[model samples]
Structures are given as C-alpha cells and as structure tokens.
Target chain A: MSIASILFAALFYLAAITLAGGLAYRIADYARTPAPLKIPTTPAPTTTGGVVFRMAREVFLFESLFKSNLWIWLFSILFHFGLALVLLRHLRYFTEPVWSWVVLLQPFGTYAAFPMVIGLAGLWARRFLVERIRYISTPSDHLMLALLLAIGLSGLSMKWLVHTDVVALKTFFLGLMRFDVEPLPASGLLYLHLGLVATLMLIFPFSKLLHAPGVFFSPSRNQVDNPREKRHLAPWAAEMEK
Target chain B: MAAEITAPAYRVIPIVPALKPDAMEGVKPFVASEKIQDALGFPGTLPDDWHERAIAKMGELLKKYRSLKVYLDACVHCGACTDKCHYFIGTQDPKNMPVARQDLLRSVYRRYFTLPGKLFPKLVGARDLTKEVLDEWYSYYHQCSECRRCSVFCPYGIDTAEITMAARDILDAVGYGQKYSNEIIGKVHTIGNNLGLPGPALENTMEGLEEDVKEDTGIDVRFPIDVQGAEVLLITPSADFFAEPHIDSLIGYAKVFHAAGVSWTLSSMSSEAANFGLFIGNYEQMRKVALRIRQAALDLGVKRIIVGECGHAWRVAYSFWNTLAGIGAGADDPYALMLQKQLDQRHKQPTHICEYTWDLIQRDALKFDKTKNDHLVITFHDSCNVARASRMGDEPGGQFDIPRNIIRAVANNFVDMDENTIREKTFCCGGGGGLLTDDLLDLRVKGALPRMEALQAVVDSHGVNYLAAICAICKTQFSKTLPYYGFNMRMIGGVHQLVSNAIILENKQ
Candidate 1:
C-alpha cells in the first residue's frame, strides 16, 4: 500500500467510526431524555401515521421553512435535495459493482451539482446580506457555509473542469470501504473533494450537523398531539407523580 | 431603568431595519422579592453555590427535557428564526431573536456539555456559564413568551420556548427568578389564584357578575361554587373574577351553563386555570399547581372538567395536565389512575370552553342573538398558547376555528386580523410568560408592537372596534397598551364577552 493510500484509509476509518459512534451516542442520549409533555407544535398531526407524514413533509419538502420564508426555503431545500442527489451519486464509488439505480442516477446527479453550488452561494450571501440573518450568524456559520461550498465546488471542478482517473478513484473509495487498500490517485481536485468530505464526516456528529438526526428527536415535531388522550409521563416525571 | 419608558403615543409598526445588537441589553424585569421567592419554594437570595447549582440544574434539565437538549443540538444558527419573534420585531433587539435567545443558553450548554464547545468555544459561539451570561439569560428568557412562533418556522421544529423554559428553570434553581411569575405562582399556591382572590372574594365577584347579567338580560344565571354532584367543574383564570372583559366572559360561562342546563361548580381550591408555574417553566411547580384541579375534581365530585378561556392555562390543561395530574388515562402511576377513574371517559376530561360552546352550537342547543353585537366590529386575536400549544376540537385547526365559530354565532361583524398574524402564527400580547407586571411595562409595551400592528391593520381596513381574545394576559396586556396605540382599552374584550352580549336565553329565544 502507498503511504498516501494508508493515510487516506486511516482518515476515512477514523471519520467513519467517529460519525457512526458519535451519532449513536447522541441518539441514545436523546432517546433517554424524556419528553414529560406533549409539545407537538399545534395543527400537528395526531396519529403516528400523521406524524410520519408531517416529518416527511418537513424533511423532504422543508414544509416549515417554506412557510417561514420563500428565499430561505428555496435555497435550503435546493441545497439539501441537491446534496442528497450528489451524496447518492457518490455511493457508486463505494459499491463493488455500481448499483443499477446509481448507474441510472449518474446524469441527474451530475446536474444536481449546479443547484447545489448555487444554493450554497445564496445561503452564504444571506449571511452577509440579510441583516437579521447576519446578526444571528456567527463566524462558524459562515465557515460551515464556506466548507460546504468548497466541498461542492471542489467536487464539481474535478468532474467538469479537470477530469480525474475514475477507475483509480473508485478503487480508492472501494478500498476504504473494504480492507484492501489501493494506490491513492495524485489528483489535487479529487484529493480536495475527498479531504473536505472526510472533514465534514469527522465534524458531523459534534457540530451543528447533528441537526440531521436532532430533527427526528425534536419533541415539537415527533410528539403525538394526543396528550388529552393518554398521560405522557417520563420515568422521572412519573416518579414525581408518585 | 426604573420606569424610564415613555411609550409611544401612536402605533408604529417598526420598519425592518439593520440589526441593532443588544437593543434589549439593559432591559430586565425586577427580580422576585425574597418573600415571594421563598413562598414558591425557591431561594430567597442567590446562594453562595449558585454557579455550581445553576450548572447542575442545567445538567439536570438537559437530562430531563428532550426538547431542551434536542433544541440545543438542532440549532444551526441558520437565522431562519432570527426575525420570527414579535419581541425582536418590536424592540429591534438582536437578542430577542429566537435563535439569538436560544444561543444565550446554547453557548453555555456547549461549553459544559458538548466537546467542540470546550475545545473551540469561540468557533462554535460557545461561552462559559458565568454571572454575566446568567444575567443575559435572566433578561432574555423572561422576554420570550414561549409562544412557539419560531418553532412553526424552524425547519427542525427547534422550540426556543423549550430553551427559554430550561433557562428559567436554571435561573430559578440559582435563586434568581422574575417577580411577576414567581409571585403569581406563589399566590396560586397560597390563595388558589394569581389575584390572591379567596373563596369569599370570588363568591362576591360571581354574585356581582350574576346581578350585572340579570340587569342587562333579565336572566337569573347562577354562578355556583363548590356544589357537590355537579356534572362539570369549570377551572378558570382568577382574572376572570377580578378583571373586566374577563369577568364578562365569566358571565358568559354562567349564561352558557344556564342555557345548557348543565350543573357546573367553581372550586375555590383550584379556582385558577392560569398556572403561572408554566411561566417559570418549573415542572414540579407546574405539576403542583395542576394537582389542585385533580384534587378539586375528586373533592367536588365533578365528572368532567372544562377549562375557561385562558391561553397558557389551556395549553397546560390540554397538554401537561394529563402528565402532571393524571387527567388522561393509561397512567401507570396511582395518582393518575385515581383521577383517571373519576373523570368522565366518554369525553375529553378537561375540555376547552370554546369546544364546549362550539359543541353546543353544533348541536343547535344554544341560540344567539347576533344583532345584539351589531354595535361592535370585532377581530379575533389568537392567543399564542391556544394557537400553537393546544387544540380545541378533535380535529386539527379547531383551535383557530372554534373561537371564530363561537364569535360568528354571537356577532355580526367579525374580521380576522392579517392572515399571517392569526392561527398558529399568532404573536404574543407581550404580557405572557409572566412579563405582565408594572415593572416590565416597558418590555410589555414594546413587545406588544407586532400584535399592535396586526390589530392596527384590521382597524384600518375593517374598522375592528373590539379585539376579542381568549387569554386573560392578552386582555390585560391589550387593555393597557391599546390606549398607547390610540385604541380604547374597552377594545380588549373576550370571545365569551361577545357571547355574553348575544346569548339568547331559552325564554327569550
């Protein structure tokens, strides 16, 4: 194994373990912390099925964001959906034989980069332009935006501007997924994209990126609006009741 | 800082301007007096170990409330909720922004709890739990009415109210709490209501209301008290006994009960529905206040408990009462089981008054003379608690419609304020979350600005003379601040007041 390949493999391993383990820990913490009250934001769906539907609209459509602001909704949804497609496209590299669905999604995912870049730019601009947004935004917020933009731009550049050895790149990612290590391709843009992606993964569980899993645990969203139907006593609260 | 606020004489919907950071910096409500704090089972003064105690309390709360921890984790500082708060809009205080307000505690949470915050505090906007930060928490958390306005807008449904509650709980744990909320919570504990209205005072007030209604409509409506074998126990706000428009609504309840021929009694023990413990965000305190209702129900032998028109009280009654006092079924706890066995199982145990009235109206059991309200052009102000926190009927959006339906049944001219300003997106009346005291008058006046603007909008196009709301706090807040906006204080009336005016007696109809 090349030195570069070994280093990259180790970095990927650390990031993967950290991301998965940290998420599990955070999720366990959330699950254990009891919601003593039924705090579903009202007009919230009452049943489990309805809650699923509400979450679907929230996660997929950014329904609440859509209600809040047209501009933030447009950029945020575009960015998230575009990121989804781009992430899906990258799944091809990790799979031994590219899945048929992934093969079919290649063209659409390639175009998704355009909106992803544009969306990140718009979101970034709002940080500096919109006064209230700018006020609430911290240096880390701007830095996070820049990091995402850099990742997207770097990925796009390697695809469109500077063609990389795809066969070598796939081997590298697949090797990272498997124990078999491969020689790392000496492409600057590919390295940039992979490095930034690794950075994002490493920070995912610790940073505000936890919002991805945090959304599901949000009592305001996930709680059933049936407080009047059943008593919702957390163990600690139930102890108090006694 | 001592009553320096010269409130604007004319209503001004503050133009969206550049974010002026720290606009509400010096703005803080007076602390709860030592006696008041002691009365509520809180410390009389800040303890020597307050820092440790406060941090410990935050850790304890972080473990207890999933909403608090989840909200703290979920906020990305995306600023989606920055401009969503009415106080932020009214005061132009960046800290009043829901996200900024959450950050007041989030920064501290990050420092003590999260790894990134410890390693790189400034990088993630994390700060240590210091005295200054505690002061900021005191000021800003009190400013938040816990209305859940920003929660509706948040993509992740990050409830800043949850954060605010946790912060207040932390503050209270450290012997620092606002006077208005603590005083009221203590009063409810001691005298059964925020007004400190004892059984005799309440009885006198009810007698006066009955006579007033008799004079107006010649209906001998009886406001019964602690009558055994009554079918319903009406848990209402004490303001309904002490305040105007609220008292009118109390009369409306009496008339409705009189018309429906339903036996209902008011318990002096749990006389109040407005639980100020909710304002302080102390679960034990909230639960203690709520338990009175269950005890009252058991003592008075009431099968059903119907809540009167109060915002946060309905939210508590509808949302937390089941958990706290066992109003709902399927509780493993013996206390819950005790109450559950007694409450009527066929209907919702604690029902909203609007739902009750609407149910009667739906059944065509109640008749209203709409022409009686012809002198008043009314608009509905959806109280933040009922709008966002609780539901009315079995169906969703019933909270919005039921009150309007009741109004439509009673009144001829009804116009909703700005569409964006009503329903689940309703703004607070600035007096909620226990900021209604004379000391917080400036904060209350400024915080009332967004709501004032919406009310003004309706007045301009629709000539809305009466701003009918279901909250005692809303009625009280608007009664004081509406005159500041050049509207008559009489404009702040309850939905039930309109119902009282137009409710046709069985003999007359």
Candidate 2:
C-alpha cells in the first residue's frame, strides 16, 4: 500500500470514531433520566470560604473517597494516574521531533504502560469479584475496562516489540492533529494501537467513566449540609399557606 | 325446618358508649384556609417585585455555592435515579418522580445562567422562567420530604433534595415563604419555639406535669424549669408539654431521670427540640433556632443538654447544634467538649435520654399493667426521622427493638405490621418536610396511604385499634389522616405514653 493512502485511512478512521463517540456521549446524557430529589439534613457551611474548602477537600483529598472500600480506592488512584500519564505521553507522537521529555522517558513510558494495563485489569477483576460492586457494574463498565487494556497493550507492542519508522509515525500523527490529509505508513502494530486509543477517547464521555468529573457536579456530596430552622415558603406553597 | 336452623334477623349490638354532644368542640382538625391566610398571606396578590426578587435571590444563592453552581450547571439528566425514591415508590405520581421534580429547579437554573441556554434556549431544552414552571417547582418540591434515601442509590449521588431546598431558600428570600412555616420561623425567632409558648406558659405546663406525676406516681416529681446549677438541661419539643402522646413521652423522660436520680431540668426558654428552619432551607434561621438550646443550657448552668424524642429536633441537636452554636468546632466543638467535660467532671457518668430511658426500663425489669391500655389493640408506626435518621440502628429502637418494646408494653394484642414497616424501609408520615399544613393535607393523605394501607392490611385481619407513633408530628398526622382514610384507628402515644400508662404508681397510704 502507498504511504499516503495508509496515512489517510488512519487519519480519517480516527476522526470518524472520535466524532461518533462524542455524539453518543451527548445523546446518552440527554436521554438519561435524572434521579429523584433528596434533601439532605446535614449542616453545610454557608460561607464562600466554606464552599471552597469543601471543593478542595473533595477534589484533592478525595474526602468522600475514604468512604469507599480500600481496594477500590487503590485501584482508582492507580488507574487514574496511569491513564493521565499515558495521555501526556501520547502527545509525543504529534510533535515534529518527539518532545525531549518523551524521548528521555521512553523507557519509563513503556514501564508505565504495563501498570496502566494491569490497573485496568485489576479494576475489572475487582468489579466482578466483589458482590456489591458487581451488582452495580453495567455492561459498559466491562467494555470500557477491556477497551482500555487493549489500547495500552497495543501501544506497548508497537513501541517495544514491533519496530515502526518513528519519522513516518510522527508525520502521520501531526497531520491528523492539524486536520491535514495524510496516509499512515504500513506499520501494522501502530495502526492497531492508534485504532484502539482513538476508539476509547471517542467513547470516554459516554461511558460510566464520565463519573470522574460528574461526581464534582453531584449535589449530594457538593452542597452544604445546613438544616432549615426558619420557615420559608416554597413559591408554590405560598398561596396554599396564605 | 327447625327454627334454630334459620338465623333470626341479626340485631345490631352497640358495645361502645354513644357520642357526647361536645365530643368535637375542642378537637382541631388542621384547617388549611385559616392557617394559609394567617401565616402565608395566600390568595392575596403578591407584591409586584416578588417574582423578580425571588429569582434574583435564587441567582444570588446559587452563586454563593460554587459547588452547587457546578452541580446545577453540570447535570446531564441521566435518569438512573428515577426509581430510587421511596416517595415515588409510595406514590406513582410523575410529579413525585425525582427527575421531573429536579427539572423544575434545573431548568430555571439553566435559563438564568448557562451560555447555551441564553443563546440557543430551544436547542438545550431550556425554557424561559415562567409562572407555570415556578408553580410546578413549588408543587413538586414540596412533595419531596428532603430524605436522602435516593442519594444512597444514585451512581453520581446527585441529591434532588439540594435543588428543592435551594428552591425553597430562594422563595423565602423573595418573601414567598409559607404561612405555617413563616409563623413557626417567627415563633422560633420570637418565642424560641414553633409552638410560640413562652417561659411562663412553659413553667405552667411543667407545673401541670408535676401535678400529674404526683397523681400518678405518688413521688412528687419536680419538673423543674430553667433551674440554675442543674447538671443537665433536658430539651424537648413543646408537643411534650400539651400534646397527647408526646406528653406521656415527656413524663417517661422525667420518670427515667428520677429513677436514675440524674440531675436535670427543662429550660423554659428552649422547650422545643425541633428546628423548623430545616424545612425552608434557611441556614441562619436554623442557627437562631438552635441557639436557644445552647443559651438555655448556658444560662441554666447545665453541664450537658439531653435532646428529647423528636425526630428532626434530635437531628438538629445532634448534628448541627455543635457546629452552629459553637458548641463544637469541627470535632472539638463546645457540645462535645462540654459533654466530655461533664463525663470527666462528674464522679459518675451522665446518660443521654435514650441511654437512660432504655437502661432504666431494662434495669428495673419494669412490668406494665396491660389493662390500662387494653381498650385498644395497638400497632407501632416507626417514625422515619427517628428510626432511620437518628442513632437508632438495630438494637431495638436504635432501629428495631424500642418500638417493639413500647408496643408490647402498651397492649396485650400488639401485632406487627409488614416487615418493611418496622425498620430501614419505614415510610414517612407525609407530614414531614413541613408539609403538615392544612392546604397540603390532600398530598399528605395521599402519601400516608401506603403506610395506612399496610396498617389496614393488618387491621383487616388482626383488627388494629391504635397506631402508635413516636414523633409528635407523626402522631398529629396519623390522628388526622387515619380517620380520613376510613380506618377508625386512634393515634396512640409513643413508648413513653405507654410507660406512663403501664408503670404501677407506688400506693399512697
């Protein structure tokens, strides 16, 4: 196959999948019904400082995270950190000359990919093994984990086992990032890895994985726990009260 | 055919006495119209700026909580939380459904703030803030009891209650609070209680209880009020002062204290345990109401405050009093610090009302005269706020045994409701979330139907005569609602009421 055609195929396939995934996410969010309204009775701090402190406690310290099972907590931290590192490393492919840090940590990236794969596997296993966790896990949960593992393994294989022309790969990735048409080089393992990662990114927002950011927006954990002592009328109840 | 074989026309046998002419004179069946007019200023035209002011206040309140702002802005409307509500399960009304209910608050939030909502309102499913939408929010939000039951099942734990509360707060900010609620708030501010009974009235009530104690127990139980230098101040709801069931419960508290020989007095100023501010989403009001208890405790020179058997009252006392009253700063607040200090200072350990009450009954192997309560076949209704929200878990009324004990103590014919009726799955009385107003009676009756039906199922077979409930409001609601549903069951008092009836008074020579 011609180099230009291969590049074009990879670029076009990635964009299509990304767009499809993004649309699916938007649809799921729109289609999903909201849970029932529950008014918590706990006292919440009313000051701006109080609210900021609470957010900080939640985001950085995972204040509520301590409430979850220990094993789940460990796996979550590992998987999230590994996933973030891997995403950072992927930026290496889109640069003309691979970033200096990416080059320096090429070995570290390979090592980090192993844990990322293992962490995803551990999480999937734990979900299946734990009865309570298993009950809550949906089909999408298992699929996301399996897909993540595949992407990590394929990327590692392309980097460590199968030799790919680095210059050709960089050119292909940069072209895709810049919205230019380019064909991928005939690097079989690279295409497989790129295909898996691209698919996962597109599916990211739609899946339960979105809970990572969604928790912050949840009212139960975020709102202050102030009890109502004074009588305030709900506007609807005002007329009835009068 | 033998004459015996043919049953004669059945004669109506009336076993009970005929009703007296003035049987209904003093009985107040919660009237909504009067209360609505007196407290809420309802039916009258609201001020011209009311809507604008309320919406503006809502926006400001939303802005106050950056976290709430994010949550209100971030909801993807995934309906996974729909079937998780007890209210929705109890009532199939779509308005009672959480998603539809939350949409009432979320839509307004979106229209006011979000960029896409502002630019392309239709594209985002956002609509302009209208009176119709406001009415829907008002109706449905009130339907919610602010129970966190759904949060337990939610994947993201999105609390719909927060939206409801915020909505109420905004309404209050705009001068649209309900009459009953506003009146209660006014009372809490002015008289230190929702009931609006002042110090002299409280003392008089205590004196009446003292006389009742003398009549019943022979022991001249001093129901002291605001007595300085008392070791502990027992704070309870005003319902205990005059209300039927709760009054007995209050006496039960005094008896336990007397039995244990613990030094405690009721503070006339802070007789109520319930903090109504919880219903309206007003934090400052909550603090002000809670402050009375702290002030009373300090003024009376008590070492500790023992909250009474009120649901939300106990919740506020235990949960927030320490924080808001400066009784405790985080873990090291004054309530805790004082409690610890008391534990350390006293040569003997002091007991909480729950601990002391349970211990006294258990320690004495207290026997009851079932004949005193034999007039009714009673079934216990576990108050959701008390059984679920409070410290009670499994050891009897911590979750299970207390009510069972109380029921068995009262009537020989005590029968159980369905298993879910007793414990973790106990249904609310529908009067909670401050829906006890007369206008909301229909909704409350509808909500109480599930519990009523369960009670009726047993009453149909076993023939329940009385519905024993713990919380005062539950008792009040049951007394009114049960009769409406064609069930002739009387609202029996709490465990303490049973204790008062059953406990043999020492013979006065």
Candidate 3:
C-alpha cells in the first residue's frame, strides 16, 4: 500500500500499453505496405515449405551471418538464445504455482547470464575494435548496447550479491498480471531491475528492436524464389494492368 | 588467337586493392541532361521545392513497398555485410559498404519519418533533407550497381539493391537522374535500342552478320530481322550488333537457331534487351521499354520470346515483365491474357538464351567438337543478376549450373573460379547498372578487383585463359578492365561465345 508500489504498478501498465499498442501499429503499417515485386535472395527456397524451413534456419541459426563472419555469428547466436532462455526464466515471476518445467529451468537460466553479458560485451567491443563496424556505429547503437549491458549486469547482481525478497517480487509481478494490486519489495536492486525492464518495453516500439518483428516481414527472406513460376502482382500494380 | 591485347605491367587489380579509405572519392556519373530527363517523364532539373518533393516521393515509395520500408527499419548495423560488396572490397571507400550506402537514404528517411530522427537526429545519425544529403545520395547510390550481393550476406536479407533502387527512384523524382541510364532509356524509346540504331541500320547490321557467318564457316546462318511469324523473337542487346565480344555471341545465337532449325528473328522495334529503365529504377520507363518487346512479339506473331544475354534485362523480363508488360503468364487482363493465349505455353514465355542452348545440348540436339576449343581453358563468371535475381531451366540453382553445364559440354578444358566467388555469391562485372559509361571508369576499373583476383588464382593454377560470362555488361567490363589486371582482354566473352567456338555448324546427323 506504499505510494512507490502504486506508482510502479501504474508505470508497468503504461509500459505494457505502449509496447503492445506501438508494436501493433508498427506491424499493421508494415503489413499494409505492398511488396510490389518478388525479390527473394537467390539460392532461396522454391516452395512455401522450403521457405518456412529456410526462415527457421535464419531465425534460429543466423545462417547467412554465420556464412559472413564467424566472430559476429558466434557472439550473436549465444546472446539471442541466452536471452530467450532467460526470458523463459522470468515467466516464473508472473505465474502462480510456477509450472514444473519453469522450476526445472531455474538453474540453467541463471547460468545463461554469462553468455548474455559476454556476448553483449563482445558486440560492444566490435563497435570500437572492428574498423567497418566502428565506422557505421551511430550514438544510438552504442547506447542500445550499453542499455542491454546494464540490464544484464544488474540482473546478475541481484542473483549473485544482493538477495532481494523474491517471494514478494513474484507477488508484485503476479498482481500486475492480474488486476489485484500488491505491495512491491523495498529493495533498491528490485526497483532498478524493474525500472530498466520497463524502459526497454517503452522503447521497444520505436527503436531498432523492431528488427525482431521486422525480420519476419522482410520480403527477401519471406518470398519464395518463384518469380518465373508465378506472376506476383501487388494490388496497386494490378491496377496498372487494367 | 582472336587478337593479342596484353595486360599492362601495372596491376589495376592488386589483391583486392588494399582498402584505401577514399580510393574512389568524388567519382560520379554526369547528370542527365534536361532533354533526356524529360524523355523519361522526369523533371528536367531540380525544382524549387525539390527537397519537399523528394521527401514526399520517399514517403510514397515507403508506403508502396514493404521491401523499402522494412529494409529501412530492419538494418541493425551489425556490419555482417560490410565486406560483402564488391565495390567496397575493390575501392575500400567505407561509403561503398552496403550498410553505409543504405544509411545514406535511411538517415534521411529516419529524420523525416521516424520519431527518434524527428526528436534527436544526431543520436540516431539522421539528418535533414538538404543539398549535401542529396549530393551524397547521387554519388553513393550510383556507386552501387544494384547487384544484391549485400543481401546475400545480410542476416535479415536486407537487400541494398532494393534500397538503391528506391533511392535512385527518389533521386529521379527530384530531377537528379544519371545521364548514362536516362539517355540510354530515351534512345531505346526513340530508335528501338540503346545504340540508337535506326531500322535501316539494324537491317544492314543483320545483313553484314549473315555474310560474315557464311565466310567464317561456309554456313549461311541467317540473322533475320522483323520477319513476320517467326517462331521466336530474339530480344538481344544492341551492343551485340556492333561490339567485339558481344557480336561474336550474336553469331552464336544465329548459328544455334540455324543448327536447331528453329526460326528466330530480331525485333526492329524492341531490339535491345538491356533495359536501362531498371538501371535508373524508373518503373514507367522500364515498363515503356518492356512494352516494345510485347508489341513486337504481337506484331511479328512469335510463339516464344527468348531474351539475349543481358543481366538486368533478364531480371526485368523474368521477374517484372509479367507484372509490367504481360510478357509471361498469370495475367488477368486482355493485354496479358491475349499474349498468354497466343504465345506457346510449352516454353517459358521469356526464356534465357542459355536455357535455350542448354536444352539443345541436353537433348543432344546440338553437336559440339570439344577439340575445337582445346586452345582455351575456360571459366564462367556468374553474372550477378542471373545468379541472384533470376532463375533458369525450372530449378532453383539452374541459373548457376545451366551455364556451367553448357561450358563443360562445349570446351575441352573447363574449370570454375574460386568456389565462393561463383554462383549466388558472384561479384559484379563492375560495369553493370549504368556504370558502363566513361564517367565512372575509375569505379569500373576498381570494382573489378575481387573478380580479377579470383580469376588470377585460376590462371596461376589451372590457366583459365577465357572467362566466359552471360551478361553483355560483364563481357564489356572484363574486356576493358582485364588488361589492367595483367590478363588479355580477348580472354573475356559470353558462355555462348565458347559454344560458338566449339559448335560444328554443318548439319549434323
């Protein structure tokens, strides 16, 4: 019933609204835009099933980037999969009587922070170390890396050094998920972690984080290499026919 | 030996040119003259409200193309594709890096459209639409050949070709069109080809080709022109009518038609297959040039349309022609529907000449004496457009293999260049996408470095004396730039040029 707890709860709701609504609008805008040509990068799949498989390799494996540079690929895949595992771990905070699988993943997800932080550090180094990468890095690019690094390091600090009231933290997150409001923990560590998470959510809709959803809508990856087999005409382009 | 044109002692292609930071600085093509710009229906010069109009055009295109919009947003600047561009590798100008080139437009796009750009432009590397920004667009966008080599390496498949095209389209909208492509497109409209050969000149050139073939092999291979009711209408580059290595490929096509007994005629109306409309990224101009092919096809009453060895033209014909001018199937309207009903469904409506010749070699319908090409050790330079943008012979990698298969079938000694440098990962010939003009000759010479390095490796080991290509631009580029790399210029030619060297012209049993 503390004022800080109530304010934090309201902030979470606002963050959730912005993340969901902004992403929805951005995605709708992307879907509404017409891809006027079939421009799948070559040696690409010819069938719908093959395209799905190809996309799976790209999303899961970063196949093209793997072919490009081994150094970047290793760091990228490690960071992404580690983040995915850690996200699964965070699900325990919102679910009551956490699922048995979530209980099982607790230790492995805790250890995933190593790759997550190390991977981010490696990528950050390339922003300064690699000549080509250094030349192209904007201020926002380094800022994005620093932000992610802060989140990862702070979360690890809570796990290793500062022990917060985890039971109350779960209660607070679960209350936010449900309509019932509960008091948040009074630990500064807890406040810092929740604050950074909320900031990422707020920026998610506007930032380069759109790459996550934007990759799926990329015409080059999504389109089948069948321009010769099928005549793909956008609606506006089809108007030209008449 | 065709002719001795030895390479210079100084190496224009020295191990990928050592990445000099500003090796190709301030290199830009001449601006399109007002007359040429007006011919393509673009503004003759920059109007007073050019900035607003350019931004408005970018906004329209962003809404119209998901590729452009998504590519603009999706690039993470991970630099995965930083070293992939041939121009960047060859010139070492950081701006030539695909991501940097994309960022040129993306910064402007972000500033005007995205929130971060509007609020805090410096942080996001976004800038206002200004004269300097417009100049960078003109310089860097043209530096790109629209080859899509960057897309092959991008993790998200962010095609810089798509971005380059969109940028070029925006530039053209604001009256900053390049002279090379716009002027060539104007000529194609007026005189039926890029060379501006009138009907009389075209007819006379074909006559001269027929006589030359008779003297060479005692074969009366007819180079028919605008013949009514020919079985196939050959849409080749006008350069094939006059240029050295290109003209040889023309004779090869003529000989193939004669040997196969398939009647094919060159169109006086749509004689050129190199559509500069695609080069300038003008959809209407591309469509207008493409419509000539369809019109000629209808008038001549050809059953099939076989495209000549041109890179972007095949991309247009295979990909956009169906959508643009109804040259292929899947059209609903009367214009496309009529052609669909009239043209032969047995063959691809717009088939590649390589696919045509390969089918003959596959069917054993054509005969080649391998010993005839024993003097040459051949290798194939996969044309960028055919390898990446288009397909051949109904399979996914048919574009890569069919040409190689044809080369192996014709030549006694055939070896592929470095494996990574061939196929879908092929480099541009440096002269593609309207860079073939003299103004960008430095870029043309420099961009040939990676490809020349790959060719030199083969020459040092396997002695690949002939670098056969399928694109007219590739042939012209290598012919010009090869001598600078200490290789003979005549060593570069079309894949069919090899076929012409080895094919027995006599009626074979």
State the displacement of the C-alpha of residue A214, model 2, in Å, after optimal TM-score superposition. 3.9
Q: Which stretches of candidate 2 lie over 4 Å from their true place?
A: A1-211, A216-242, B1-56, B63-91, B328-352, B361-379, B392-416, B460-466, B504-509
Best by DockQ: 1
Put down candidate 2 lDDT per residue, B194-277, tens digits, no spaces: 798998988888899889888767786678887888877887778888876678888977766665666788877777787877
Query: After aligning candidate 1 to the native by TM-score, how far in Å is the CA of B234 from where it should be?
Result: 0.8
Assess every candidate by TM-score.
0.97, 0.64, 0.97
Q: Score chain A of each prediction against the true chain A by TM-score and list the results.
A: 0.97, 0.71, 0.97
Cα lDDT for residue B337, candidate 1: 78
Q: Candidate 3, after superposition: displacement of residue B254 in Å?
A: 1.2
Backbone clash pairs for candidate 1 read none
**CAPRI grade, predicted model 1:** high
Better of 1 and 2 by DockQ: 1
lDDT tens string, model 3, B149-260?
8898889999998888888999999899999989888999998999899989999988998888888898788999989999999999888999979999988888899899
- Show where candidate 1 strays beyond 4 Å: B2-15, B330-333, B506-509
Sort by DockQ, top down from the best: 1, 3, 2
Docking class of 3: medium
Candidate 1 structure quality by residue, lDDT tens digits, B1-509: 43466553333444564567787786788898899888878888899999999889988998888888888888887777877788887777888988988888988899989998999999988898778888888888988888999999999999888888888888888889888788888888888887888988888877887787778877788888989989999999888887887888988888898899998999988899988788788998998899888889999888899999899999999999888888876676677777788878888878999999989999999988899999999999999999999998889899999999999998999998888888998888988888888877888888888888888888999888999999999999999988777889999999888988888885333
What C-alpha lDDT do the candidate models reach, one value each?
0.87, 0.60, 0.87
Per-residue lDDT, model 3, residue B80, is: 92
For candidate 2, give the docking quality class from DockQ: incorrect
